[model samples]
Target: MSTGNTIPISDLITSRPYTSRSFLRECPERDPVQFPALWYYPVQAKAFTICSLCYNTIIHGFESGCGISFGSFTGTKHQTLFCMFGRPHPKYLYKKGDFLALRTFMASRTGLKVTTCHGLGGANANLSTTWYKPRNGEINGMVSCEACYEDYIAHTSFSSRFEKSAPQPAGQVWACDIAVPLIRRTLEACSEGARNDWRVFVAATTHRLKVPACEPYKERAAQSTRWFQPKDSLPGFIICEACYLDRIASTCIQGHFTSTPLSSGQIQHQKSLTCMLSYFPMAIAVQEVIFSENFQLWCEAAKIFMHEELCDGTARKGKSYTLIVKDGTGDADFNICQSCYTCCIDLFGFGSHFKQFDMKTHTEAGIAYSDWACDFYPTRYGFSKYMDALNEAVCVREFSVLGDFIARYQGVTQPCPRSTFVKGRRWYGTSDFSACPDCFEETIQGTALESMIVVRNQFKETECSCDIYSPSMRGIWKNACDTYDYAGFVELVRHRASVYWQTVPVMKRLLSQQRIRLMQQQTLNGSSMLYQRLDMSASASSSINYSGYSQPRYTYGAADVGYGYASTYGIEAARLGQQANNLVQSSRSDTTQVPYLEALWEAVE
Candidate 1:
């Protein structure tokens, strides 16, 4: 469908009742733009022209006191100039004809020409150096950042509260000492190119770190114990009756524990969630090695171990693998180790955090850690080297996930040759937007495993290529878009549609068959009911009352025999019954046969 008249985009967008005054019949004047308090704080119009400079000056002085310098800072005058007036600069608020004058002034003042400063941070950059803590506390739940401050003014002053409260912080500065240090380390390790890809890597890391930590802040204090209170040793904390049992099988079902036991038997109550990680550091050793530090060496060795242990002769048979090291004699034997299990699970997942070992680490010729002596092994042969290797593996895993997403979108088809639609023609892997051969075939496109699943579902021993121009395919794509992190699935669908418009005919045909099958099933059900009614009528006629129908005139070969009419009707009734049976059989056949067609339609769609 066509709209009756061509409407301007701006008019269409501003057509809503709340959007513009002309759109609504009657209403008091309200703010044109809606500001999200979660995104920015609301301050009075006057505050921007007064408090902002004071706020900026204070922050500037504070930073200066800390031996830091800000290239630029926001002032109250700028806030009112931007928020109250929709102009680029203070001069622009007064100027009527000269928009370029503001740019000229900005260049003169800063001694530099600038366009934009988007995508400035990286995942593996020295985050500590850039971390800043704003002077003002969180307002309206949003961090007080320079961008947020500017945004607050750019939109209308949302709330009158800013009028009463002190001036909002000039801008947000990096906060959280732990987060700053970790981010810094990450940035330092990342390559320049990787760092430059700020929107993807850096943003994702920061986003993950921003996840709110659990609350009900724990106060650090020593637990007081009553001397000789009980005969049984309850230790530092009480254990739940259900989970208190010792030496239970791994498969045995259980509930939340009163404490995280040292083993299946020994009880050790945890104070907090952090304690869960900190209590057993070795348990996460593999994870730390892969994600926290460089763990290339350990990853390689781990992979080889997994392949040998998990797979049976065939290279492609293994889905995943795990490794459990038994430290016969170590500090872990006497204490607790949580990192131990995590390391094995991470390797099993084949997550980017762990890297596979090189030829040297895999071979006997090179230095490698043994499960027995590695815990306290000397330098060069020490376990720290292995730990470092694991950290690299973790980084690799993260990069791998990111790289895979990028590669898929970019369509890097060199490594994995596959056919994709291009202008209603088959375009092989040589196209500019070709996909990665391995990822495309093994993960995204189609695979033996998927074929096996399809065959099993259909109860067929053979595999077949799936039709891309099918409703089922569309449904699958929609589901992936909804469930997975691929934000560009819809774009890909649009691209595919543009490339393969001709496939629309095939999809329509499949959809038509699907609709027909539904109609036919309904028809068959109706026919079955009609046949049943015919049988009931025949039964009634066969058992007719002689008193009501003294003589049946329309009997076959009646020959003036009034009493024998019932016999003739019974014969005719038997004939009708046979016909009804035939119709019922036909209806059943139609219902059964339509299922096959429906299956085919699903495959095509």
Candidate 2:
């Protein structure tokens, strides 16, 4: 337990009954009362406390021989100090200037101002009045809080470039620009080069920050400006100017790309362009290209990088060939495409686990064909775990170790206990619908419904109608949880289901008829009008909040609706109703339109 002059590990780690009410920023919710905490008071008015783990990790630097000991203080008689670091210690183990050297060394590293005001404890510069910003006064100029300025910039060669600024207005939150990765990288580069030119730094930072964001999967009707596409390779591949500068411009492979021409007129068709370097696997390929300085090799490898597109199982038209798990059964029937196999399996040395599947042959043999979907797609579940397992296998140099992890995903046919519905079992429900264990756990367990869940005993193995995948259901649950309105939640769910069943089919039919008419006309003007109407209808029905999550606008007529739901829903309902009436009237007025109902009746035969 003992390590030289240090305190025994057993003594330091022993559980204690005492608990502190105050919580540190690192562990904001609860105090880990069992471990000892170090409290530092630089002045009588201010105190900062850190748990033992933080003390060892950040302050003590985790050196084995480094230890705290009793020491005498020489400040003031009024200052009732416990330890040299501001805690009390036994006089028997006291040694003169025990922590003086350590404190001085730490102070030199963090700077005198930071040590005096914040001590070894961390500080948030945004809350401090002494934060500094660039003298140029640009709106997007670099700003560093007091702690950051002292700890990172004060000791550097370009320390004098910054000047103290007034604290932000009360209730307004501001963050140190140095916290941004790009800004931090720029600062580091300046430090490494020992560059004291403030103008150059500001210009570089401002220019980089002002560039448009990198959106690889953005679909535009016309060609985009300031974008780079690969020359003579990967036809639809494009990189934003920002991504080009940040990731590829400095590399030797930059010569392989050409600037995409700006659109001269409105384009009739939309094209989705994906940046090759933005995808992780392609980024790795680019890194390889950078190291080898071989652009052609990257082009060959890049052909297999499908930019997360789903494989359609078409040998001639598909971006990549379909790859299925060999001898797979039950849940192990993985339909990974060649792109995913290269990135997730072959790239990690697990190629032997899979093989190419002949989808054409299987279809000809009276088998149903489904489009190949990569189980390890970025957005799919278990993807993170699969990636972690692959990395771990590579790290340990045992490629066969991945087999056990992959086996967990195979040969598992039974639904999870949560998703299963059993007869004579109690389930959470309302009068209209009962949620399976899976649905309850995911959508209702921890919410306001926790107390209000109506337990029901099932008489038969009936399918649970609770659709957790429905965005409307999710939106309703979120709103209900936020407001804690159990009655409103039940009524809303029932109303939504009723309205959806009645409306969706009619809406689909109308949309289909409109699509056929536009196609028959074959005019750009007609297509534009149809798209405009669809956009208007969609916007009127659903509005996305600032957080980028879809906030479904449902029209509920419930009387006891809580927190503005009644008024909001009523207004949205009236608007949607008017739009629906207008659409129906337009369809009726179209004398030249084909009768879709008759067509559907004939096609059914």
Candidate 3:
């Protein structure tokens, strides 16, 4: 068989002791192939310094026809970076890859595909990827070449065309090493409860290994058989260990945000029923309860999560919960009057948003400012910064909830098949607009019936005199409605006596959405109840209090003392700009001023 000459891929992976600290501290590439993964194998202990050549290698590897060979180097200032050079030029026509999809692939893999396309070009390249192993010594930096590299080029080329213009995927090795390990560790800890070890095993093999197990090997490992398969019964890429374990959260297990099992009584057919609770106006506000002082102590008694939950009890209380707040722009004053709805959508998939308002109003005499508009008065919410904060908050909440919930619930200990809750409905703003299987069949069945009616009425009537609406657009909308069984529409007309021209259901659905907003606010009470709660600086929100205005004495004023008055009076400009900013500065000055004044008096004594 010439087995000795042919080195198996498995043999390429050698067992090397991996310690979080050691791996982080030193580049073990020279020691041996301790880590598993093609990108990280062929161990070499060198500081990762990727050059132009390495970049070209990555690009060429990803660009199917681009003839480029990549040489990766370690033991330098830059860790695990490769110099990509020379377009290898393909002999055959490489498929014109989907640039958009390739960009998506690069993004998903935490790699950059920087080509000559984007104006910035190679200047954007980072010397080190966060994925680079970080430690405390000369070897503190190590490249995750194979781990990040792999067949990334091949995958990126097919992913999307967007990768062509953006930065070529770099630092992916570092990203994979850092992100995957962190995520896997988190998942493994969560999956510890699963007796079969299926959750952790699947995560390690598929996500960590980034490959499928061969069929022959799967058949022999009987004792660990369950570990090889997905518990959810859906066949696709295996989830990472952390994500798999996080699924054990109580929300998933309790079916609060997911689907329920279909009973046999409902369907005579062999297929299972699918249901899901689709949320509306997808983007929701995440309100973190903030306290003025040490108010978290009352949380348990109040039966609410408070600011302390965000930090330790020793610190102040702070934490946020995802919720759908009503858009109050239509109201008379344009205020988001605290109306809210519970955010009941799944954690991943599509995401949500939190909307801010401009609460400024002008009076006849002058522009009178309200407390609501204070945050944005100077420079309306820094939109980008606000969005960034919102994203961080959401990520933290999603992961934290998953972690906490899994610990409390046992059903999610392993993958389990579950049914959809409400089929055919898509939330308006949140992601997950694509129609699922349940809606597909229903719409197909309804199409013929609808077509027949439209044909029958084609010649019977003239168009409406109003002429404001388009029958075609309405028809398209109707088809969309039919195709997607919107729970919003269903709830709008649930109590109709007849099917002809039903209106009550629609009104009810609208009212129901509003009610949700109110409930979101009323659920939690006590010191934590406030709208604008965040960790911004104290001075940014407070008013400055100074005993007197700074008045420089003028010699000329003495000449006119009898005829004129020396006076200077106005609130500090900063005090007017940001109330809290004044307070913080004022407090500091006051603290130091008192000591100075005391020292002066002592010298006189």
Candidate 4:
């Protein structure tokens, strides 16, 4: 065997000096060729150990004077170290007494190689493997994987407090609870105080770990019974107890929120409550509010922001507004709702490109007023592309540069044509309704079940269901794609189609009866005075305010809101028009039927 060239030193030191600050630097990448060595400072009460790589980095930093170095070192060869596999922790420096104890303990055990824990590095633990956990049943939930136990706890005074947990049932997935940030921090604090009391560490972390995971982790665990809402009532803005505790409880604006108990009845009746704070943007906004200590400013800003987020700006009572941008020809117009204009355009410094369109003046000119919708509404397909283009434009500080990208999505309400199927183009979905290459790429291309969908071979003039604006359908597709349940998705689609066809005939008969009744009523009230009274009644009803707002109530039928999929298979234009009236009538009387009807309509349309 040949050894690489090595330099001879006058004196080979067995140990090096390093400080707590020097260990703060990033650890070097692990090299498998070098056996792992554990090194620690002698004076500290820190419970964790650093790997050879980090130990070397700290020494180098000390030698280079890059870090303030102070402390004696004790070194020992270990099979594995936590720093090599777990998240970086500045407090993971070794103590000489603990290191010597760990070395003595390792020496006693012959042929023991605890290389790595199954749950180290944020990975799910293999519960069937040998692992250590708190002996007390109350806090037994806190688990330390085998590698972590050897590296951090086995040599510590509190090692006696933990016992080997029974190998969990095979196929069970469990993450080492000790790896959680809160628990890790608690352990670090315990080490700093040189506290060998296991109860202290357990008491500090038990409640936090016991709190149900934040809203985003709802699937893994149930939410707490309590939730928090803003003191200034903002509809639909709710934060789970867990998120509130973790992110908001200690914040400056914590007083601005009030806790609300979620009863079992309410939980059963309503959809799973989501924590609005879990949204990345909302979380960031809350953090900003915390930093600024301006809850009122956030509240005022949230009125418009939340309104834009919650309301789609369709069929509202108040006067609708639009931002119309004209191309060079002046004939081409791009309409954006006030919400979109304020949030997407003006917020991004692109307001100069658009002019406000006066709906009242336009209607006064005899042009019929149309309900305006934001082009970049959250539910809209290809919204991400618009956002990407906006981001690119912002990055370059040139809005005009991405004109083609903007125009590409504008007025593209129809499905891709057969001519779009050029060579080397990939399509997704079934033959009956396939997504064009562009739509697939924008929406479903990278989804989990992307390969599960059969590629369309026969190029036909079929409508693309991918562009449908129904939230329910999109949600179903998303769930199916996430779980790779292609068969279940197809079954659901077929089931929905069956229900739709069954409802269509019933809807048609109801609409026909309503139309006949209306005609009869008109015939009975043939007098002009009678018509005047009916008009007056309608006007009075419009002025009535059931809610706090004085705006007239406007109801929209399915037909009034075009799904941009009129040409979809098995949907007749006349039948659709008739069903629209029925939908409108049903919506006014029975709001529960609206989602069912909409979902069915979305399935085929």
Candidate 5:
């Protein structure tokens, strides 16, 4: 309490009339100790000699020699900017813009009365002057209140007073480190591009780093982060958790970018979040390989060079092969990979920062990673090797993706001729793409192996004129075949694993009228004396192209195998040709007699 005589409180307290609060506590064994000093709540008009708005605490700051000062509270003082004991803490926390408008930090504390009052528990209203320190010497612009002071003393142990105060937080630097390094050498899996930019400095209330100790003093320290932590060697970034969450939602997930310069305020905010891709490294791998610019180039390239058919999805049916209905085709076309089929290409969007996918879902589906990228592997991944990375970017990107496989590791450049002719089969041999002649009939064209009966006959060479290899026949076949190979699955399921059916005999008169030109006697002129019938029969084993699906059980001479390449070529040619030529059609094959190709699927009996 202040004295009318103006005696220094330090000297007056030495007279034994006043007692320290610590020594004044109640003890049942002793009577109340007599002392005159009352609780001095500092939250009053008398507590401040300087106004926060108009005041400058430094008395001799940055002047000449002895550039020192004292706070308004000390009668005899020394160097240092001073106000009360330390930076005063205001009672209420302020938000970003609120700090600048604040005029006064001083507010009311506990009310005082003339009469000395005691509580039932013997607790008295008495506070030590040292109860409120400078928040461990860190600058606090907040005004102290009775509750805050009590809170301060509650946690501050008496032993802590002798210990040195914690160091003050230095003010913040206005700029963040501007250097941005490439996430990787290649953006293969990275679906988006990023601008090299300065780190964002959010508002002071949630400043990850310490800022200026002013009217709006900083608040929380060591707040939780909302981003992937930078590599240990990299400089740390300080963004508001709000800014980070919003930035990710727009940049990564939605594949968007902002032209607006960043302010401390953010357009996006969330209650809570974290980096979405922090866990999946392979997608990170894919993203790193695919640069945004390069990905854009590839998308453009695909728009140009991809077959005209694929542009119209509904019009293009994937791979064409024979179905069970009597020589009908599956009518297939190119197809997308399993990944693309399941998710939209827009997920990466022209190239966004966050182009990630769930590998676990793919694994749960039991799909091989190869199958997942089967389409992309052959075409898109290798684009960079072929074209200029920038100018011919489209083609380069496209080549990098779709055609690079040809140049990469010197793999096959063109598909096999039979696969082109028979469109519905997926030929997975030891190579990326493969086809053998025999496999053409059973798998490619979806014909059954066990159903065909081979016939052997002796025909005079002079009469067995190889006439069916005509240009007209090939021309008609060409019209029906799909030239552009569509990305797709060709029913390449394990045929050997399928149950087989032994031959069942069905008699039909051998007709020689449909004989097509033989292999044109290319190797040996007219070496084959045997002429085989082309009609579907069960018992005989005379077909030239046996199930390429498997090898023949018994060895057979050339004479026994009489049919030639023209047999398959001419009939389809003739069938399509007759339709094109408007020629009268023959009776359709009896499909009811045909055995199921397999119990699960259409396989040969």
Candidate 6:
């Protein structure tokens, strides 16, 4: 309902809009709702200045310079923001009020009854209630300001105690948490086949691209139904029109890193999967195979991600992938022992190290260094990274052979369920402790029966361990034999496509968890690969040039480095000490006896 009465709307608004912006050093609340919005306008813009205490009305603005019109003019500086008088909104002129009716009664009353004398007062009881109504009317349903109302409710909402566990007949019990599904969500990772086609994949995990509008600003915000780019091929720079305004107008930097998915004019070709691949560690190493470049600028940047003074190739001797650019001078080449040369070329990516060592005594000094390739090398591995690469290499050969075999044999592939063989039944949720349903039931029954026959048996003494004696567990083994879902996992294992689909997510999770553990370990160990490089540079005074190569003058890991990655690592080390204490305090005899098993489990992850 417009009151049909109005004043020139002051250049202000009542509420603030929230913005999460990066690279915004500071943002002041001053601008109008349009353009860059500010929380408050310096002046109400009514008169030169307005009332500060009650912002609803203007105070004095006659001759003060803050700007604009009318009324008694007092030539004062604009420093006093508000008028000394009471402030009320312009709407006050139109709001109508109602009057109250009279006389509801008010009185003081008392009543009593007789009782037996022994009952303490012939007194049955005496009661009195007092009420005073000077004006004989009722007042109720008074309203409060938004701030005061919020404060009142916040202070009074909980009747008595702080929130904790929900009350139950027992002390407290665990809530039934929502179960996370075992499926992997494949996001808009434009598949390999699509890369060669017109539809280009954009870098978006959260937001989707919307259809492009010729005049985007004139339109109401578009729905995320289509990509802005008209062409099938993705563009080199994938930036949205809206993102540009946010950066330049709103000072937001979030979308600056992302590229616009829409292409202009002719669609640029072949710009897909590369964006997804870039989000990986050693991305350059992976990308180098896709593109023919020996190196890219992005690769060089990533090389220094975790290590400094580290060569792109290797420092050990004998190994060379591509010859170092020698400026056409033969003297640029130097004599590195074969062992050193091999070590140099092999250790390339993150946490990726390799060594050819004497199998009998594989310590640093015992390393073969550059045996190059032993006949046994076909089957032998240098280190874990090398082993993975080698295993992959062998697989490639077998893959080709398998390809030939399949092509000639001409039989349809019976989709094989990978989960059946890739891991134990427990991994697929088919069985616990790697045993099938029947085997597990049989073992538990045997153990329970044999243990029950002993001298201090659970079947006889209440004093016997309740873990083996409890009535709740009495029929558990028998129940397992009858009601277990033996068919559910069996079906999952037999269906190749479904099993592999679920397995992919499980593998991805395991890899992620493993990576986190590795980073934590690297943080704790003072001699991590990155730390090793820093230690070597700690005392080096100056750079040394051998022939054409220039030595490093300073290690980036110096004490004054801006981001000291190692500084917070001590907290993790302290957490590790705490974990050790907890494990020591635990009473599991099996845990104490097989210490290496527990340690290996943590280390492997």
What lDDT would each prediction earn against the true structure? 0.29, 0.48, 0.25, 0.50, 0.24, 0.25
> How high is the lDDT of residue 530 in model 4?
46
Please give the distance, in angstroms, between residue 151's alpha carbon in candidate 6 and its true position after superposition. 20
Tens-digit lDDT track of model 3 for 1-605: 11122222222223322323112212222112211111221112222222332233334456434332223323321112221111111111123444444333333332343211111121223633222221222122222322333222222231121111222255432223222333334333443333434334334434434422223101222221112112332222122222222232222221212222324552344232111001111113111111111112111111111111211112111122222233432212111111111121222211233323333544456865444321111133222222332232333233333222111221111111111223222111111121222222123212422222211101112211111023332343355555664454233222211221133334344445545533433343211222113211222333244575433232111321221112211122212223444444454544554445445322321
Q: Write the per-residue lDDT of candidate 1 for residues 1-605, one digit (tens) a residue.
A: 11133222222122211211111121111111111110111121122221122223223244333332324223310011222222123223223334244233333323222111112221222222222222243222222222222222222222222222233334433332222223323332332322444234344335435533321112221122101111222233232211122111111211212333243222135332221111222224323333323333233322233223221112221122122112322112110011232243333343322222222232355655322211211121213323333332332323343222222222221221222322221121211122222323323343222212221111112222222334444455446644663435435544654444344444556556656655665565556556556545554555646777534334443333223333444444444445555555565655555556555443333
Distance from true position, residue 342, model 2, in Å? 3.0
| Model 1 residue 23 CA deviation in Å | 73
Better of 1 and 4 by TM-score: 4
Kindly indicate the candidate among 3 and 5 with the higher TM-score: 3
Which of the two, 2 or 6, has more lDDT?
Answer: 2
Q: What are the per-residue Cα lDDT tens digits for candidate 4 across 1-605?
A: 01222211112112222322223222422222112133443222333344444555544344223222333344311223334313322223232324344334333322244344444244433424457787767584777766566555654566787899876665567676655545655565564446666667778678877676674513222133467888766876778776776667645777888987767676666646667666444554565456446555356445545554433524432333333334464422235555455445544345666666544444556876555455565455555555555543543345763454454345443344432233333345673345554555444544686676576322334333333134555566778877878788777666755675576545655556666756644444344334445444554566546666543344212454343221221123333344555545654564445556656655554
For all predicted structures, in order, the TM-scores are 0.18, 0.42, 0.18, 0.37, 0.16, 0.15
Scored by lDDT, model 2 comes in at 0.48
Q: All candidates: CA RMSD in angstroms? A: 32.4, 21.6, 34.0, 22.9, 36.9, 39.0
The true-versus-predicted C-alpha distance at residue 488 of model 3, in Å, is 58
Q: Report the lDDT of model 5 for residue 131.
A: 19
lDDT: the better of candidates 2 and 4: 4
Worst 10 residues of 5 by lDDT: 176-185
Ranking 2 against 4 by TM-score, winner: 2
Segments in model 4 whose C-alpha atoms lie over 4 Å from true places: 1-63, 66-88, 91-132, 136-170, 175-224, 230-237, 250-258, 261-275, 278-281, 287-297, 305-605
Give me the runs in candidate 2 sitting further than 4 Å from their true place: 1-132, 138-155, 163-184, 221-225, 230-234, 251-274, 278-284, 287-297, 306-331, 348-350, 360-366, 382-384, 387-404, 409-605
Number of the top-ranking candidate, with lDDT as the measure: 4
Model 2: per-residue lDDT, tens digit, 1-605? 11124221122222322222122223211111221223432222132233333343344543334344322112221122122221111111122334444444333433434322232232454544466886657536456766556545664566766688876666655556665445555665565334765665677778776766666444433444367878775656667676776667645777777778655441333344545556556655565456446565455455555433533333232323322333454233345565556645554345655556654444556875544445555555555545555543543335544555455343222232432334433345666656644455446644656666665323335544443434556667778778887678778666655654554445566667877654444443444455546545665567656687655464333343223232343444445444555555565655233354334322321
Rate residue 586 of model 1 by lDDT: 60
